[model samples]
Target: MARIIHRLYNERAFRRERVIRDRSNPLDIYNDEELIERFRFCRRDLFELIEELTPDLEFVSDRNAALPPSLQLLIALRFYANGAFQNTVGDMVCVHRSTACRVIRRVSLALSRRLARYVHLPNEAEAAAMKQQFRQASGIHGIVGCIDGTHVQIQAPSENEYLYVNRKGYHSVNVQIACDANYKIINLVARWPGSTHDSRILRESALLQDFEEGRCNGLLLGDSGYPLKRWLMTPLVAPTTDQERRYNTIHSATRSVVERCIGVLKRRFYCLHGEMRMHPERVCTVIAACTVLHNICISKRIPLPRHHQPLPVPEEDVRPRPAVGIEDIAGRLVRAQIINQL
Candidate 1:
């Protein structure tokens, strides 16, 4: 009886200590500047966001002490900023490798769910503002967003491995993004396999449907890889006149913002630049989470890291598709009209 009581008393003391330690940890050890350098957010903001994410990241209050939410956020941020191996991040955060993996996955999923509100395309009025901004920046009229596709490398899957292998002979996901004039991503689609063509992905998206139904306004400027439509504009394949040539030049300059956005995204979240070891579905979740964080940085006016350079995108073979509707013809006429004006 005495031994059992002693054991129970010890257990209670341990639990009390752990609860106090967890509560006091973030406050005592990490200052605001240290938090910013490590997690890329001010300490107060990080703590508040972690508090909000508690419902998703919190584990059952079992006998074992669970890791604190702030610590989990720190692990996720470090992984995102450095793209380090799971064990490496574990060492930095003083957790087991498997625990670090769980923390990252859970935190990323929670962020993607709660933070997606900031990453969407603007509404009608906001889009008008976006168009005015683009026009002022590049003298391009009615341009809502710039569209492009990039390959995010991933490990070869056990099933459907060939489908993920891109034209560059590597496993990847062909991520499509549409960005505004300020280099913020307005739309993103990342589930497609690397082997999927850029044009097919855009054609199959809900954004295309919205544009076709006239629910959305403004045209998306894309490179030659995208199909020209009433709502989506591409540079002329072969410019025969000076007007067409001038149009292409302006189109290239304005559309390049999407490329820069992608570059900044990869630079900010090094995980995208590195070969993601997670499954494709998990990778998509991570991508979504990173995009949300990227928008947050833009909203807060966080300065980008120096020496971050945009990489060159490969010019893929243009795949022509049959345009059956009046929309295509109308788009061609608009292009011609714009060229004539130029």
Candidate 2:
């Protein structure tokens, strides 16, 4: 039986002859040149953007001694691109794990500081442009931006699990973000306790501080979870009339930009989809870094899904309507609720 088996294996190998040929067309190898050219073009723009967004650190006297800023940017991009851990990034970048960690932190801080200038709430002119764009795209006017909060999972701490556990039954941090109709993040505030309500988180955030101080003239669109306030609007709880129902539908459709942004953000960074491996304190920093990168991608006009279009705005009656006093009441209630919760 052993002899038969050996003969059978030998016969199979003999039947399958290996072929080596030098006659293959050399032109096939040239096909990669076009790909290389495209890659170079992409790299050129990406590198320049990274250089502009990454601040020069004076802490290290010899810039040449440290990793190249391009390499540092590559590390951060890899984090968002692949959502890999430090060790994996180190392996791919050919650096030590500790070095990878340090590089990421350095690059994160540098980009966050530099990119903050570009990723802020829109000014009057910019807001006006966005309004006009919304009018053109969705036919709705007076729309500024959408606001919402999402929970990011974090590792549970042995000392205080309650502070980290959210309503979703996970250890997380509540992150509130505001995005324009274009889906570009305008404002972001992370570091709230997971147990905190969305309304409470918004009340305590600096994102709302401008609106509170009457510095912002644009309105913020939100869901029912957010308390109503001047410069901030929420959908009506129940639509009693056709106009109210239509308004609520429009509100939901347009307000979906924030939710879409959050979804895209989570889909891009797998680490954010579930519990992060890092400590809780570091989670906020990571989140901020991710958001800054998100804004950077947006500024570059990276292609996204077509569903990301702003919700269509319905035509309104030209007649003047009575001013609703709900904004003040909502603001007061939100402030009081936040204080009580704290």
Candidate 3:
């Protein structure tokens, strides 16, 4: 009888604690400014978005004391902002490690569904406007978007891990991103392993098909790693003439936008800056989530984090090629036409 009475008392205490925690406002812990600094979004805005996608009701039973939607969003944002482990993030928000993991997965999945609304491939009219903006910034005509690939480091996978090892002697995901002048991600393809070549990723992408079908107008600027195609423009192998040198200079500067975007992205989300310890598939979802968040930050005009800085792009290696090929001829003819206008 004493034991039963004790159990009843403990249950009541636990219920009381849940009531207090749920009623407690997170704003008391951190003001709007502090909340924005801690997580990238202001408290009001973040709560509204989370509330829209996730109902206010607890995901788990009230007995389990599931986290509020606001706390769930906060925990996930802190994870993305710092790339800290589950335990560390949980401690920050007063939750267990396992609960932290569940919260992050749930929030990531939720945000990823809204990716289409945030990140999109430009339509014909949008592409024209983007190209015009690029021309105004730099006198490069027929340029639609800049294309490049960055290696997102990841832990060795369980199966055929060797395939994930890149030339840099590390496991990574080779992510291809296409951005316009405003650094908005027009298209993103990130399913390939690190060992995969940048050119291969592009060739396998739907964007390549669009170019081939002439559905995508204008040219895409890429670095030496990609092949010279009718739609894709790469720098000259050896620019002997003054005009060729000027063209290469302009091409390098214009293409640097994609590199800059990659830098900004990694800096904003530190998870991509170093090796991420997660399954390959989960890593892909996280990468997509970060991309969507990056776009949201841009759309909302949110200021970058205080310590944010871009990562430096590595230098490219030289590659041998055929003296003369059909693709080479086509690339040169297109270049010659652009140079004449210059």
Q: Rate the local accuracy (lDDT) of all candidates.
A: 0.81, 0.66, 0.80
Model 2: weakest 10-residue lDDT segment is 32-41
Candidate 1 lDDT? 0.81
The TM-score, computed over Cα atoms with residue i paired to residue i, of candidate 3 is 0.86
Backbone clashes, each candidate: 0, 0, 0
Instruction: Pick the TM-score winner.
Output: 3
Stretches of candidate 3 exceeding 4 Å from the true structure: 1-26, 55-61, 313-329
lDDT for predicted candidate 3 compared with the true structure: 0.80
Segments of candidate 2 deviating more than 4 angstroms? 1-41, 53-66, 136-140, 304-342
RMSD of each: 5.7, 12.5, 4.6
In model 1, which range of ten residues has the least summed lDDT?
A: 18-27
In model 1, the number of clashes is 0
> Which one wins by lDDT: 1 or 2?
1
* Per-residue lDDT value at 29 in model 2: 29
Which consecutive 10 residues in model 3 have the weakest lDDT in total? 16-25
Per-residue C-alpha lDDT of model 1 across residues 1-342, encoded as one tens digit per residue: 999999999998778452212223444577766655556667666766788888888778834668877778888888997799999987775677888899999999998895448777789898999989988877768889999988999999888999999888999999999989887888888899999988888888877887889877898998777777877877887788888999988887788788888988888888899899989999998998889888887887765544544556434345543333334777888888777877
Per-residue lDDT for 196-273 in model 2, tens only? 777777777777798878676667777767767856767666457666666666666777778888776765554577
Model 3 lDDT per residue over 100-133, tens place: 8888887777777777787777788988898898
Structural similarity to truth (TM-score) of each candidate: 0.86, 0.73, 0.86
